[model samples]
Target: MAHTITGRKRLLARVRRIQGQASALEKALTDGTECAALLQQIAAIRGATNGLMAEVLDGHLREHVGAEGLSAGERERELDQIAAVLRSYLK
Candidate 1:
C-alpha cells in the first residue's frame, strides 16, 4: 500500500464531493441557473479540492518526510523536497 493510503481515501472522498458539486452545477446550468451561483459553486469546489490536497500533502510529510526513524541528513533532504512541494502548491 502507498504511504498515504488513508489520506488518499480521504482525498478521494473529498473529490467525490466535488464530483457531486460539479453534477449539481451541471444540473443547475441545464435548468438555466444564474451564472453567479454557478461561479460560486465552482469556487467552492476549487477551495475544497485545494484543502484536500493540503491534507494529503500533510499526511505525506508526516509519514515519509518527517518519519521519526530517519537519519538527520535524510530528514533534511526530505524536508527540502517537502518545502519545494509547498512552494509549488502555493503557486
Candidate 2:
C-alpha cells in the first residue's frame, strides 16, 4: 500500500486496463454476445488483475526485504507478512 510514485503510476495503468475490460464485458452482455466468449473475456481480465498483483507483490518484497536495510526483526516481520499474503492468494 506504500508504493512509490512510479509504482502507483504502474498500478493506475493496470487499473485503467481492467476498467476497460469490464466495460467491454458489459457491452458484450448488453449486445447478447456468446456466453462462452464473455467467459473468456472474464478469464482474461482475471489474468490481467492477477498479473498486476504479482508485480506489486514482487516490488513490495524487493523494497522491504532487499533495499530497505531493515533490522533483523523488521525483516522477519516483513517476511512473515509476505508469506501470509502469498498463502491467502494461493488459497
Q: What is the C-alpha RMSD of each candidate to the true structure, in Å?
A: 2.6, 2.0
Could you give candidate 2's per-residue lDDT for residues 1-91 as a string of tens digits? 4665668888899989999999999999999999899999999899998989889988887778775669999989989998998899889
Q: What is each predicted model's overall lDDT from 0 to 1?
A: 0.83, 0.88
lDDT of 1 by residue, 1-91 (tens): 2556756677778889989998998998999999899999889888987888777777787788767899999998988988897898789
Best by TM-score: 2
> What's the C-alpha lDDT at position 51 in model 1?
82
User: Model 2 off-target regions past 4 Å?
Assistant: 1-3
**Candidate 1 lDDT (Cα, whole model)?**
0.83
User: So what's the TM-score on candidate 2?
Assistant: 0.81
